[model samples]
Target: MMIKSLLRISTVKVLILLAGLMLMFAIACGGDDDSAGDSAAAPAAEKKAEPTVVPKKSVHEEAEKKDDSAASGAAATATVAAAKKDEPTATAAPVASSKYGGTLNWGTAPNNNHVFFQQYTPGAGAAWAMNIGDPLMAYGKGSEWLEAKSMAESFEVSPDGQTITFKLKKGVKLHDGTDYNAPLHKWNLDWVLNPDNAAVTRPQISAIDKVTAIDDYTLEVHTDRVYTPLLNALGMMGGMPFSREEYESKGEDHLKTYGSSSNGPFMIEEWIQGEKTVFAANPNYHQKDTYPYLDEIVWVEIADEQVRGAALETGQVDVADINSKSTDVIAALRNADDIFEAKGMAGVRLSHHNAARAPFDDIRVRQAAQMAIDRHAWNDILQGGEGHVYMGSVLPPTSAFAYKVDEYMYEYDPEAAKALLEEYAAEKGLTLPLTHMDAFKCTDEQLEIGCTDLEKREITVTVGKGAANAARAEFEAAAFNAVGFEVTMDIAAGKEGPRTFVTKESSFSLRGFGVRPHPAGSMDSYMGYGGYWNNGSYGTSDAQMELHETLKLAGQAFDYQEQVRLYKKCQQIYLEHALGGVKLANAPSYKFWTTDLRYDGYPDFTEVFFPSDTSLKMYGMYLER
Candidate 1:
């Protein structure tokens, strides 16, 4: 299928249908607003940032068009960009018209997984944890997605590209009053790098060999190799500082529930799981001269899309994240007056095949599974025809190196898939109604609640608590079963998170991967040899090995054109060889905030949220009223 045709959507018709159908529902669901908490921290001493106009066009779309050049330029100039000590990026003075204080009630879905253990949970708790901590670097200003100074005041890369020396800002302290210095930064990186921790983002920073603190405010990072994406990795969650003192004293269990010290703009004030998380402005925030305009930011859990939208419409909540799955609700929000909306590519949903076991171990089986999926139907069913583009090995269509789905993906062809599966079955002498055994484990709580049938003859899949996952599982089961296979989907009845989803014992499973800072990140995380995410589906085939090698070369390449060329080759290799799983579909993320809230220098939500941190310089944000 042509990439243009795949992305073609009747935007006018979709908007019209959604607005006409869901407008009444949204209006009727409006309810009373929650009470705002009192401000404890005194007002910031510094002036607000200067007012800047935010464009209507999605930054994600613009990024897709500009990244090819930006990424190449960064890579080409890596060696020439000498090491230098510089001051932190300054925030210009805020406009006199801007007002300063109000609670920002944000709406989002509830997370049932581990809280405060960000390295483990990619769900709700992780979001809160990110907001609690801060990172070393962040996405640069404007639409370009390059790394810039954040916590680390300045940095200089060694001429060889294997080491990075950082100059940390002085006088910064965590919520518990621990010094936020080079030693603390090294400790944080070590925590993430520890194999026993099993941080979900470990692969992103795995290239780092070690970190050395040259002094209280100076640190050096040594990588195992050239590791081109190191800076980008540091700007993400893995590089966020975590206090070693708290971990040693408070213990992991205690910190997991009640957060530790924070060096970020916000500190955790209260957390009532499944209900809400409230964060107060950090009085000792490093950039105290100007930020965290809001007194408190509350993340209220409203899993229902319609109600979440209604909350925003009725002024109950100042901001809410709209899931594209609920097309009508999002459409209504988009058409709503006096609301500012920022859109970005969230991530892609793909089926992660278990290559460690049969039948996914066979390339033909993997290829057949890929061909069996009805991408268009799945997209419509999951996203309500929101016009999300199909994803490839590399994603978001905005990474420095990305390709059209057709260039490195299989088209939906159930007939061919059925033929291939039949040939495979005949060759392997397999029988109908093949009993697939999924290795099942139970949590202690689940076991206490009477868990049974720890092992079963079905393809076990884990998903959220809703109709969406069930429908998706059904669609997937029907597709594969129709194409010559007796696929019985055993929805894991206990946990509704990734713990069950990532197990290698399942006959097969579906996993959703979020957007990464770089294309090499996407490649290595899912397809690299012995990659952390590539757990069950270890890519060991000759073609898979070649793809991994190509990725390594691309990671080390300094020439912009050479990097692009090598990445393209990596994509071609992924296309020719089914790397662990098949690319399915992707979705767009939308951020909606009421007109009452004003931002002085509001960064893109994609940048803030994607890193799974509160990179928002909230000090610049305030309520007009």
Candidate 2:
């Protein structure tokens, strides 16, 4: 990814000098350090970067014009150069003026009533909540900073780091025409913290001791201890506040019976369950200047990816979420000139293992299981060589806290896997059931791949199948051998299924952790005793405990260098213990948007694309006249 930032010439000069000296030493000693050489030579290697020129025709047509390997290499080189330059070499088309009025037609998968408060998951529901409800804090689009000037004007952390004070944006009105004040904030917090609600956001704010309304617009949130990801967590689903009046008057089932009552830029005008949800601009929104350029936003449920793509192509829908499975759609959209744009961000796909169970409890068995499957082949088969192999770490290399340790990556070794499985079978004969949820189209294929390899190793593997929820339930009940699922740091950190697994209510399961903007948010959720995904009783080994401690220290450590060092240590510990389950492959989440949708502040299309947080805030989004 090309980061837009001014180049520091002085820093580059120093880097060049260091590189030159290293090259001299390497040549003098006749030493071969290809990786080291590449890193050192990167900065000084090029004075200017060449931009990747997307062909005017289809990708397939473009591929036919040039040598496939050569073109790919050039693109890779150009990408690295652009990243080093911290700027886009190609000139982007000028963004047109944002015009308000038209209804933005959006398509999404079925929500199954999870779009309501307290029950909403982080998938599609969180994305909807981001636009419908206001958060106390927000993350900057494609930026590392946490934006505090949203729902809350300012915030203060106590010197002890246990208390946080927030001043609400004055004059903000909820969808129900009630004033948004400190009491409302406290009310939302109380509801989430209430065990009766069983809110998924509970674990995210579990460290908070209490929330109190200091004044009409002032709120105080005190934590039991120093919670590191508190601010980031607040920027997520946990921070969204609902209308108190609607909840109280309409009753507990109001959200389900009626609709969303939020104080964001938009309010639910009408919701035809399973069909569509229509939202109109909130007239009394706090951020009046950016209240909403679109007069109405209609979110239609389109389960089929191909159908969603077709809708977007035919101008029936303005935006849709497309995955790797929608390869033809993605290619078609990418080929379309100014009509459509497809953007993808790398996320992890994993096969979760049950560390608490007998065969998986044995480290060798786990290693064999991981080694049996060829991740490269999986990527080729599933993603068409578009995915990157994810090592054990949840954080991508772009993150500051990411570790450079690759020794933990289990290489595809069928011989070693067969030997290990044979040894295990000789010791104790067992039939392992490989399970997968039917929701993910690739799950069956992924399981089959693993099962086929295991069968070759003389290991009996049975296929267990069911609906997504049913599979999850069966896995939680420990009725199967290994269950396959998709996971993210936020989901794992929540109080739902991942938390139950962490609590040792369920045994072994396979899952993936996608790449997150920040490492701590995801890492903390799966690391220590407090982690939502740490079955502390069953999976907490001595090494895992040490890793947890290291992560905790990293969270508290203010020094950037110290934090990196601690995170590195934690990664080492994780790899040593093989606590990250079995990592498979990471692929970019492909999302498409119509070119007609113009965003006010976001001049670049890439700025508004975030698949992880689903933070494509529609407040400032407008249609181009």
Candidate 3:
């Protein structure tokens, strides 16, 4: 299921570039070690007697002088080495080896609710679900190709690529002692695919035609057509299996309330809603001795970054995913040698504008809003200079479909923004409200910057509450002018939100969408018809129709050249129609962990297998003694 058309640059090049940038940053920050000593010693120097002046030399004499100068240079180098005895010795403490049987205390941001199959479930909740149950396929840690390997066992795909047959690993059992067999697999697939279930991941498997159990150990899945991303989607939330017995016993409403059963390395021990979730190692895990080195894992819900950092420092939490937006927390973590950071540019931020709503319905107003915010300054201040100014596409430069356009539609120019706002005001004679969630640093800052610019142009800008779904509803009902919100990397790619945004076409809101590895996966969600977050229905323009058609073709096309061409065309249409709203900044996903947490036999970071934060293999991680 791998495509070879994308840019093939190695991770080593990225590492080298990062190293070079760090060195340059250090130098620029006046990190020279010898400066203080040199300054102190310079003032003590006294004038020395001048040596006898030398006359102009012949060619032979000049050659001799050059040889003597080289000798003096070697002598000077030796003298400098001898003078370096006063320098302080630097050393790092060695890390201790991994030891088994200790509880790992992890911390993450809390959410209002936690549900396995819902769209609004938090990232931490999703990570917990993965811990409790295995995806049919798993990607290796830091796998650049996004290769999929069978988590349970091997599988074969039909020649036509319409059918996938899985061979289940023997002797596997769920936490409730139910055998993990073909019937169980078929049940889970049917539940997700069933329209009445309203599974948030239903769109991921919309192409699937049927699922049948051939036997107790084998299952066959048939698709309507060749869907390339089916495996990737299955490797996510859609593939998560829940016990059929529990579903029938407790019913759908209470399944999550009773602590779902686990077929993976860990099982839920306790879940204290809004506080924490405790998991215990499942000794009967199918993977045998490969995982669950730790006896227990306690995931503490700590939304405040500073509080989380303090917990890590005070040995309250063994590992925590600190926020990149919290500069102080990141600084503190970097200062502590016991903490390790796993960093990579995994996502980007974008403002989703409602083109159907007035004010934003005017393309000039949308362009003006985009130009009003200073992304560079936002990156420096909010991300602590760890982010890049984002162009108006969800795909990063690494993606194959990422094409360089000749013109930047909206560069940071407050004067231009002011002119646009003035023109809009003169035409409409109405004040607009700029709203954002105060909880998120990026959106909060964007609202402030945008509002300040509009005010400068003699336009009235009002601030509104920052709730995501609530804001969308209010905007859809025409209760507010504009709302600013932050969209997580996954949600941006998945396109999860209220249906009314597409159905009613009443409100225009601004929010960011993160980057995806592939253009088809990212673009199709926003532009394709029947997509979860397709705001294109808000406008019936020819450009919008062309964008939708191009994106649809790009999603279905297997030919690399055709896919790239179609995606590029779609991007052009999107930009031309000003449908993508405002592009903000792209930042690396920064995860910090204590040095004490160790993975027995896993890479530090896995691009697809591991959760968004922490390098410790979800199952293989152990604490050092």
Candidate 4:
């Protein structure tokens, strides 16, 4: 899949120096109860960042497309490039923009069995999401938000602000045609949160306590409390509505039952375990005439990103999401006459701290680690100019919520790093060899391609005991090296880290991209909504307690600007406390579409066609020669 941003992804082969991050990091902004509270003190700094409620309704296609176009900023690029008509490359219609859609066969990691809707498959999720679900609101080319129409045409906030009413678009139907009951062709109002339905994602809606339908086109949701972003929250991946009748009856085969029906632009037809998944246009699909211009989209989840790139370069696939870490692949496909590539930065940055025993607990150790990173050197030598430099924090500079701070953040100065380490050691009786740590990562194509590329630049590459014992080994190595103590790392998927080893403070190991809820950009998740962002998931502090209470009432705080202002101030408070974790970099969200297809609605980033987010706006997306 052509993902949204070109994440500095290292195919397990490249050593990611303990992939960790900051406010700019793309943690899950996903709405999980676990992310309900703030943990530790935030680094003394700043930043802030949207909402909604609808019982249920079909999504509007045009608004989605329009918003996508705005996100890509493609139109601006297109208009300018149009002026250079003399150049064939600039004048010719974009190959990717050409219209076509069919069953796309794709592949993904074999064990992606996690059922939580919040936990979406990265590469696989991108291709499947547009077809399977609808986010509350989306931005298109030019970063335009399309909310005037669709499933949630318009909504109203309640008097006490505890309830939100949504005016839906009538005539919405479930793909399976399973309405609430017989003789009553109404949509079942119970499936959204009733875990009794046993739907895999029922837990996500657990917060909604109750649901009421005012009329066919109007839905009302009564929350336990007045959550400001409720409606918009429903538009997210987790908020996707599921049909209770469908799940209740077809519970026997969950995937077959759910996968068989989608009210979106397309319907998935087949899933061949291990090889590929294929998709086809949904005849009854709400946006039928508008969609799937081509007949199908096949995604082959190749573990090896290099192989994926190889496939693209060799024409086996029209396009592929190349790893930013795989410089060779980038170089390979860029030079290939048959292929052309575009590069964008992911918000994800890399940072690790000394959060163990004495020094890291001292903050300066983390400062030293932050300072040791030669920003220019890392990008220049390892990145090969493919990515850019960023400071600690998950709130990217581009986001509207990030509060601009006056501090320099931590910078790369081996001398500064040494000084901080020395100062802390001298003052607190800390020792040398500050335990450097990172999470254990799995070995896949990304690693091979990245390692192969890095090898060209004279960097040492080694596949340390591949995923299994990598975490333990990494921690042991780092801890041991920290003086005579054995320092090493423990590698594991983001999920496993917390359940088993999260609070082992002295023996802490770092992991990347799990601290946030869904997008990882939400104020609650960052400031500690649930356990995440708090003392490493469950760590508690007074500052965090203050922030959590404020976020709850931010809805009534004057206007949207003032509401957001409060969140910003809260972020600064968290920062001053050093919060639970240090964000290294933000991972860019990349969305890839097949070259044979044309549509509008994508995220903000560079796109084959320009939309502010480079997302193809449904209205703007059309197959053109």
lDDT score for candidate 1 against the true structure: 0.57
The C-alpha lDDT values of all candidates are 0.57, 0.52, 0.50, 0.39
Pick out the ten consecutive residues of candidate 3 with the lowest summed lDDT.
25-34
Rank ordering of all candidates by lDDT, starting from the highest: 1, 2, 3, 4
Model 3 TM-score relative to the real fold: 0.68
Model 4 per-residue lDDT tens digits across residues 595-615? 333333322223333212222
> What is the Cα-based TM-score of model 1?
0.77
Query: What's each prediction's TM-score?
Result: 0.77, 0.72, 0.68, 0.65
lDDT (tens digit, per residue) of candidate 3 on 1-625? 2322332323332232212111110000000001100000001111343111112121111111011111111110000111212211222222433455789898876742644433323334445666677767543331122222234465566656577777777777888888778899889889887756666556666678899999988888888866655654565556767678877887766656556674877888777777987889988987665566678888888878889988988889977776556778877777775666655443355445555444455666666666666767666755677755665434433333443343456667766665665566566654333332111112354333211111111112211222332432332223112222222212222223342233322123333343222333345555654444444343444555566666656555545444445555565556544565555565545566665555633232333223222223456566666
Instruction: Give candidate 4 regions above 4 Å deviation.
Output: 1-127, 135-149, 180-209, 224-226, 256-260, 338-340, 350-382, 413-486, 492-521, 531-535, 546-550, 553-558, 570-575, 588-597, 601-625
Q: After superposition, how far is residue 20 of candidate 3 from its true place, in Å?
A: 30
Error of 3 at 431 (Å): 8.5
What tens digits encode model 2's per-residue C-alpha lDDT throughout 450-502? 21111111112211222332333332232112222122212222234432333
Candidate 2 total steric clashes: 6
**Model 1 lDDT per residue over 1-625, tens place:** 1112222232333222212111110000000000011111111221334111111221111112122333322211000110122211224234545555568888887753434544555533434554566677644322122222257665666666777787778887888888888988898888888866766667788899889999999888999998766665665667777778888998887666776676777887877878887889888887655666677888888988899999998988988877657778877876677666655444456666555456665667777777888888888888776534454433443333444432324578888777776776777787643446444454565344223223545654434446666777788877877777676565645443333334444444565555454555455766666565553334345665666777788678655445555665655455445555655665555567775566643322333433221123343456767
Q: Which candidate ranks first by TM-score, i.e. highest?
A: 1
Could you tell me how far off, in angstroms, the CA of residue 35 lies in candidate 4 after the best superposition?
26
Sort all candidates by TM-score, best to worst: 1, 2, 3, 4
Error of 2 at 311 (Å): 1.3
